[model samples]
Target: MAVILRYVDNKSQVIERFMGVQYVIETTSSKLKESIDEFLKLHDLSYSNLRGQGYDGTSNMRALVALAKKNSDIGAFFTMTNSLVNVVGCSCKRRDALRDKQQENLMKAIENDCLETGQGLNQEISLKRAGDTRWNSHYDALISLITTFSSVVDMFDMIVEDCYNDSAELDDCFAEGNTELLICLARLSPNDSFVAFDKEKLVFLAQMYPKDFTDQDRSALQDQLDIYIHFVCSDNDFSQLRGINELAKKMVDKGLHRTFAYVYLLV
Candidate 1:
């Protein structure tokens, strides 16, 4: 692996130097520390002098996975889903059974006129196995599970009738206060001609940040919002904007951001 050092010199300019690479048998934490220590010693530098560190994309993803696994429910769900994929895809016979079951269900639905038929619709899909290092794999696995749920239940019935006999229960992840806050926040969305905008909710949101906005600022914000909403709704340029990102850019391009500073800040 290679190392680089970045520091500010006496001239108040930033400098970065590429330190040579080191060969190591493993990339484990201990092995990497030893290699870095050797490099520091060779350069007459001390590890204690370092102030900050950086990680690459792979390292960041691994850290996210580790953090997410701390939630017991999330961790248990992933574990169960992984095991379910393995059990269902253990052999060719089981896989074939799953496919046949899906096909049978599709035919029944088609006959009952319960499903729409199109050239590109009703394609067969298999279960997706998630990976440890990539978080998106878990999402793909969950979608696959949803699509193949009925067939999976049939497979489980053939194998063990009493496995997972307990009824599944769902827990509410958000409380009432959080739900209200989320709704108020959603009222600020600029999508669909700013149809979600609510002047009262915006005022409530401003009131929450007492340190940033005082009673006078909140009072002025109400009038500013009235004019701001009128200006954006009637203006052709703002009407076509898709999301908050485009709205923000257009506001700057048209110099409206400064005109409605409080409104833009809330956005």
Candidate 2:
């Protein structure tokens, strides 16, 4: 389930922002819908307030799209535009079909290898156990010499191969699944619960920005972060900021605005 928050300026320009995401153990869309409704009701929000929604191009979101079509203001967009990445990571209809076919072929290959291990000429019970545990050590060597290799290869050859596969790119989007970059990120920022950036990539982006940030821009940036952290941590009405009487109270009171935000279940 996901919660989307829409930020509207005084001029009424609506910019949708991602507030939070919650992973559910349920597999079906119906069950997921029920869970989402329960979560929103707990936070005192109704479906009527949602402005825009982002989704992973899944069946659940597909159902949401159909339901949302009945509502004029709701905007739902499928987020995965890259096909290569979708092949491996997508839970969408077509991509899932390809993954299932690949799994069937892999199981066939493993079974054929196991049968060859059973018929080994030097196959003592202990030696067979050793071979069973050490399949990688002898895979190319023993499997190459085996007659079953030709059939297994032929089975794989018949399937349409995805040469320029983008699954690796899509899988890289998840920080935990990509090992090398995530490892370096963890080392660089040891205190963060999860590292979302690679140092080199971040360094390149930082270099592209202007060296000097303007005073107006800096003040706006500070208030944005300050207000965001204050709202998330305290869960109090933003109207309270205007009512505070202390140092910088006059400054804080000016830009403060009463806004409605989704109190999402954060990880």
Candidate 3:
């Protein structure tokens, strides 16, 4: 399963946005793609300006993301994780075993059904187990499916309960919205809509720190930050970079002053 979140500049209109001209937030599965794509398309948003991709570790997502980044207008930077233990651990072996056990229980139900009344609940336990197998199996399968895509299932429930209020606002925009990709681009890219972070923070510090610390602490720190932002840090680095001014202050205090370099990083 792979999920991609196409980040709109928050300031841009739906119509002015291009198909790939947006910031993208990605997760490890395609399970949410259909819904997300539907959400965006309905709003007349294009993914043209996609500058980032984020995801948890998974071969399917990694391959597809690589393809998207290379071929699309997305930024060169990508964010991915090695693994999401909680999600994967639940879905891997343990879930499969539970499913098998459920199937056996359902089979027992069917066998008991035939020994008494029909497969209906009113039947004696024996008869219920007879024909009940099929029904039980069906129910179990449904439950198992839910467990498998639990994250998405949770999201769907939220969407339903909300009555798509956010979507409604988007729908209003869509009604008056132009279909041009560039127009949509404009809606998503507003400065007010942009996100910022504090580089002084640990997360940003990790990116700004030097990979190879030397006796010369400042040079080492600058090198670390460069390596981290460029190669070491994953997708989280971009989305999570902290305080531009504060980060600048530290860098300047350290003696490596290059505004263009940082700007190049952001763009």
Candidate 4:
């Protein structure tokens, strides 16, 4: 397990320091927690002081994709796309043919003014193989298909007999609650002077972690959030802030970290 510490330093800068990784023999809740506790203790820290926690478990995104694949149409679409990549990428000769065919189509399109010619425009590229671990790879593969559609179709036509092929430690409650929490988190977006900010939803999020936020903290969070939103929105320095990272940096830079401790934790 990898550990990272996010804290505000003496210079009022929000710093995310890599604490290191702890090798765990088991990934069960108790074992993982014990390992993390020991790891933090080694660095003179404890869970009591942990204001915010985030986990990048392998199952989160992969499981979501798996759930989506339960739909027959989505499942077949990805299978077909993967098969296309396998057939075209299995041989160097096939890859070269694809590049040449794509180039030929690019040239025709440019000549017909269907595509603009430029230094970087219409650069030859091969199909990308999508991986199960990262959903973005599938997105990239689909994009490549869009650019090389005609080439892929032509290649398949030439070989009508060609064969085809195919390929967060988020707990059950967290997984089931993801949709609602995600929608609430979206409301915490830093864009447009925190226009999407919702105090109730944010407090709801904080309340989910009773170990981190006590009754007093939960009550104070409401007032803190109000002040936090007002202060950030009214300030010109935060007007152009785009995301959570930028907002965090800006908060530290302006020394708001010291003033709004609870708000910064929510951030």
Candidate 5:
């Protein structure tokens, strides 16, 4: 860390001069004081010239943190989600097992007339592992995990039957109460108004509001919006929306600012 000495020069103007940086070997308050004293000494400066000082200190001892780890539902959810993802995504073989199992389930659903068939419906979709800098990655990972849940728990069951390795990626993946956590998170979702794709969805819905579009026009608008979102979201320039609500408001203001259109109600 860099340390600077603050003092008024001979010109009577306050000036902040850059002092040399020192590598800190210890972090205790006494040790930090010693380090500062040594730093001043190296510059042939005296502590008597010091007027004010700043030091790192805790503001309060309260630990009112999000996802408090001391035995809460949120902590359990985090632990369960993390452990399950680690166990399932640990190897390509396990991931393949999950996909195969999901495919089998999908086939059964289609046979029972529970799921509709379409061109891309049977294509393979696999698990997503979460990353550090992205919260949405965790949501995606959790969705995949839930979709492949029964198959994954079966794998965990098999692992425990053979030989469970507590230190390995399977740690706590098969814990009994995790199902509740999974169900809870699966039902919880952020409001659609803030989702990036939701702006187009809302606009399409507004176009169907009986004032702007007929039935045929609504379907056409839906297809057009789908294609447009697919194109823009794929392009690097329009992808990764960071201000969806602001953009939605701007669009509404542009179209329905002074009009008696029902589209203004959509905003």
Candidate 6:
């Protein structure tokens, strides 16, 4: 987790500064508070004067921070957009197909005078998984989605068209799997527990704009983080991450605890 300290300095001017990041073995409310206390003690900072607390949606975390005396909010909007990106960008083959289709559409549009060539307008555009650190990431994703909607649908059609048996896919989209898939998608979004994947990334973005972090980034980070988590989950190399929690348990059972060497190398 990352910590930023905000306060009125000796001159009575308000100051907010980065206190650096720390890792915790577990994210339960109790462990997080202990980590914070340790961080404050290590840095010789006082926690008594903390005027408020800020975080993305997590009841336990809020309760943990409340010990420091605080208030909070949640984000669910960006979560939906991230979900859309995942639904479309599940594989590199699909992503490449989407880009190829996008270029074809762009060229056709230009030929028909539907789109004009300009400085940034005609440049190669790709589907960007949302990012909170990038300025106007939401805006860019919105524009891309609108422009590439047809391409996205076409690519998905092409991918599924080759499948000899698409009965399972059809079932998932239209029948018994529909409600379960919807609920699963909702749970995978930034508003749910999966936002934990991008916790530190969100913190960096949040710290970049502290005032806006409370106002906007708090909500936007969820969307970007959801996109990130989806991408990571979709990647083959990171496939093992899907079972990380269970793997940790197995490691514990095997007596292969996280040693200093193991943690150092992992970091």
- Model 2 scores a TM of 0.20
Q: Return whichever of 1 and 3 wins on lDDT.
A: 1
RMSD of each: 24.2, 29.5, 27.7, 30.4, 26.4, 31.0
Better of 2 and 6 by lDDT: 6
Compute each candidate's TM-score over C-alphas: 0.39, 0.20, 0.17, 0.39, 0.33, 0.32
Look at candidate 1 and give me any clashing residue pairs: none
Across 174-239, the per-residue lDDT of candidate 4 in tens digits comes to 677987778777776889878898888998988768898898998988888888888878889999
lDDT of 6 at 85: 88
- What is candidate 4's local distance difference test score? 0.78
Q: Clashing residue pairs, candidate 6? A: none
Residue 153's lDDT within candidate 5 is 77
Query: Largest lDDT belongs to which candidate?
Result: 1
TM-score winner, 3 or 4: 4
Error of 1 at 235 (Å): 99
Q: Write the per-residue lDDT of candidate 2 for residues 131-220, one digit (tens) a residue.
A: 212222222323322433343344334323433245545666654435643343332221222123243432323232335434453444
Per-residue error for 164 in candidate 5, Å, reads 7.2
TM-score of 5: 0.33
lDDT of each: 0.80, 0.39, 0.39, 0.78, 0.57, 0.57
Q: List candidate 1 stretches off by more than 4 Å.
A: 1-56, 161-267
Query: Per-residue lDDT of 1-267 in model 5, one digit per residue for the tens?
Result: 235555788999886544544556776778778889888888898889788875433221112112134437746776777777788788887778777788888889889999889887656667676544433455667777777777777778766765646544365665533563343332211234323344444444554357767767555555555554454445454333345354345445555222323222333
Q: Which residue ranges in model 6 land beyond 4 Å of their true spot?
A: 1-77, 131-135, 159-267
Ten-residue stretch with the least lDDT total in model 2:
258-267
Q: How high a TM-score does candidate 3 get? A: 0.17
Candidate 1, poorest ten consecutive residues by summed lDDT:
164-173
